[model samples]
Target: MIALSLIPLYLVAVTLPLILAAIFGGPPRPFHQELASGLGILAFAIVLAEFVLSGRFKSVANRIGMDVTMRFHQLMARTALLFALVHPFLYQGSPSGGQRPWDPSRQLTLTTDLSALATGIAAYLLLPSLVLLSIYRTQLDYKYETWRLMHGISALLIALFLLHHTIYAGRYGAETPLTWLWVAMTAIAVGSLIYVYLIVPMKDKRQRWQVSAINRLSPRQWEVIVSPRGHSGLNYKAGQFVWLNIGHSPYSLHENPFSISSAPSSGPNVSFVIKELGDFTRSLHQVQPGTRAYLDGPYGSLTIEDRCEPGIVLVAGGVGIAPLLGIVREIRLTGDPRKVRLIYGNRTEEQILYADELADEDVTHVLTEPPQDWQGETGLIDAILLDLILPPVQVQDWLFVLCGPSAMMDTVEDYLIARGTPSGRILSERFEYD
Candidate 1:
């Protein structure tokens, strides 16, 4: 993808100018500084381009093998921070080593430069703290909401600092001709943040769903159902997810995205069968019925639309079957004549998340530890089991949707590839946290 290619392009664009500037002199020529600033701006532009092209910011980060999308975002933020600091430091024509006051450059080092120094230091300190908060978010899970709020606050602070530093240090206020340019760029950055946070969330709240019921499926799993008010049905395709905010500020950063485990035809009432994998989800049992819940998605492209051939193979492990359940439900509702086969694996027969519902379907249950009187497939869902269940259809033609742990997906992918299946035909969604 172009996003992958742009990573190296950005690296070179940002680094090459600094390399050339350092070799020339203590302070490079005006043209060199312009070139470096131009490169920095270009790198930021590329990040925006990558984000637009990929649709989601996370895709670009995932393409580059970064653990999270926030890392790439913070990387761009820090780059901007550094550039803002350096512009004032390097361009200031100040004399060093306590030279004679008669020097023209020495006049620039007056104590009146305190504003520039203060703003630069503030920006420098705040940016890295924001980056650290983003990087170690999982470890600091208890303070995730606090960290998120602080992240936004710091962004505003950095923006203000950059505005002040640029206006004062660049003398843009005195230079009436360049005043508009300074105002425009600052407005664009600040405006973008507001649009992403405030405007978008307000527009999204109109798509809220009312909670119908929350049934405990197991000690660590739940089946949550929500009915849309009036004629506003939550129209989402199978395999897509929705962001859930349970009775709080709509702008609260505490919402989590979960795949819709029921079909859109399930009418006004949409369902999400969630597992208590984290702190946020572990408290799902406490949520009362008739509570307000905001839904903000139906994102993700893992669907059966790409599948054209007969005999579809759906492989799911643990609660990863949520999305696949929606797909199966849709297929059954539409009365499609296509033969569908589901291979579901779980740690134990009792621990199978949707054992009862799955038994009613044309699915083969594979449990690691079955009860004494149990009659079903055993052991892991490996190449041997796949080969045994695979019909006479060509491996290249059949589409396989694998959603589970990364290790299991990797194993399944390798097995499929070895059996002459093209990588494109095998679509997978990693439900586990990276």
Candidate 2:
């Protein structure tokens, strides 16, 4: 419902400026000119809204998944860039000069003021560059932190430039009421950045946690556990993830998201099944057990807390088992009668984590490359293997939760839906490398 309601809020936010402008605007210009101005207003509004959409606010993430939210952010940014780029070109035939004596508002002529025009030109060029750089971030060799800093800085620059160009140079925006409206919108957008970097970090200082233990889970994976200090741990449902920062200031960029492999019913301590991957995670095994840590979530919507399904089917590949471990463990610890099954896949036996604990559950372990005398499943978890394990009845009624490599997830989700399972019953988490 929260996700569904966002559509109207989004519509109101992006269209409010255009609506107010039409009501208070002067004589209507040519159709093409009006379209150009309208697109300009919409693009600015969208750019401002992007700040909140991508700000990691719980309000957005809790409804639509984080992957969906970020994907929407990327798509909308490209859209706004398109609108901004063409808005200037569409005003082709308009005469350009200083304010005319007959037309004090310059409705018949484009502004000749260099300062106002310069801001618009700068923003027009920088906006596309920013969008392209982000789309190719992982392809570039730069550090994620460096790319992140540059992305934030570039966005702020574009917002400031557009704000100046809109207020001093825009036809509808120059009015007293519309001027304050743009000011408030821009202020809210800028304030969201401060809220993310400064305000949230300050709030995290009070809910500090201490590392309780760190142990190797596999050759390339480790488990890090932390106990809340002076507070009950996060009240998150199983399968939710948190942004973890260890042995660093709350404001540090060292934080990364990891699913809580530990169940909330398991106590006040949280455990993460982290695979050694990234600059921050690679050094996780070296983190001391007594070091202080901070967390900023319980985000993601992969939990089964409110689902009415009678059974849960968890599919995981490699370290994607992190969240599924929490969900299955919660079902066990709480003695919930709802049926549970886990299909965990890995490249080799050595890559598997918690072999003993998982063996006790109804888990079907699959390996792409099996050893000489392997007795268990020995192929990838593809459609064939899924057919062999899950009966048609189970597929139709069970709630399927999946977390894995992109290909594995896509394959499994498609197979499940094709086998008569409801689309809503299938949940997936793409382990993005951000």
Candidate 3:
């Protein structure tokens, strides 16, 4: 209910500038001119709001789920980019000249001054570049950290460019009330960045942590454990994740999101099962014990704690088992009476993690490539396999939690829905939306 309510609120916020412009705007110009200004105003409003929706605000992201928040953010960026790109083109037929003194509203004469249009032109070029770079970030060869830093700086630059363009070049934007609103919105946007990059880090610096252990779980996966320095540690639920920064300053952008593999019931220490995929994970062996660390989360909503479902179904693929492991441990440690089942899939036996720990549970191990003399289920966790493993009653009633490869998750979610499972009965999160 809370998440759904945010949609209407967001609609009102983005459309507020347009509404104000219609009321306070001096005189009606050509329909195209008014539309051009409206688009520009709406685009700037969205750009400002993007800073807060950058998947850093706990108040917002926690309620809607980080993946949903980020997906919305990405969608809005593309929408704003479309509106901004088309803004200047709509003024082509308008009278091109400096704002006339007689026409204080500037409804007739469009600003021809290069200084006023330059920022808009710059933002026009840079906004598409920013959006394109983000869309193709993984395809490019740049480091993730470098790309992230560039993204932030470029967004701020675009926001500033749009702000200047709107104030000086726009007719409705020069109005006192709208101008003040734009200034306040821009300030809030910039302040959000400062809070994320500076204020949050400063606070985290006090609640420090240290690396305690790093062990190889499989050929290409590792288990990293960190212990709190002085605090009682994170008050996170099972199946939550954290932005972990090991051996780096709290303010550094070297942090990466990883799911917690250690249960809250276990101790004040946390563990993550990370696959050697990215630059940071591949270099984990170089990290030493007792290295300074920082955690910026406990984010994500993939937990199964406060549910009244008769049974819980945990589906994980590859390193996606991290949070599920935390959940399993919690259920065991707390002796939860609700029945639980884990459907863990991997490509090979060597890729499996914590087989011994999961041996006691009702786990269905599916592998694409099974070794000789294998006894567990084989092949991918497809619709057929899911139907065979999960009874119809369980499918309709049990709480289904899934995390893994996008294809596998889509498959499971679609199949469950086809089997009459309510959407609310399923829980899932995607790290990659692109």
Q: Per-residue CA lDDT of candidate 1, range 78-158, in tens? A: 565465445435445543333245533232232356666587567667756765665677677555467657766776676
| C-alpha lDDT values of all predictions | 0.64, 0.88, 0.90
Q: How well is each residue in 1-434 modelled by candidate 2, as lDDT tens digits?
A: 56667889988998888888998888898888899999999999999999998737988887887767777888899899999999998999988888889987768887879999899999999999999998887788877668778888888999999989998788888877788888899999999899888999999999999999999878889999999999988889899999899999999877888999999999999999999877888888689988999999989998898789888899999999999999989999999999889999999989988889888888999998999988789888899999999988789899999998988998998898788898889888887633
Q: How are the candidates ranked when ordered by TM-score, highest leading?
A: 3, 2, 1
RMSD of 1: 6.4
Q: Which ten residues in a row have the lowest lDDT in candidate 3?
A: 425-434
Q: What C-alpha RMSD separates each model from the true structure?
A: 6.4, 1.7, 1.2
Best by TM-score: 3
Cα lDDT of model 3 by residue, 47-163, tens digit:
889998988888888888876798899999999999998988898878889867888788789888999899999989888998999999889897889988999999899889988
Give the backbone clash total of model 2.
Answer: 0
TM-scores for the candidates: 0.70, 0.95, 0.98
Winner on TM-score (1 vs 2): 2
* Candidate 3 residue pairs that clash: none
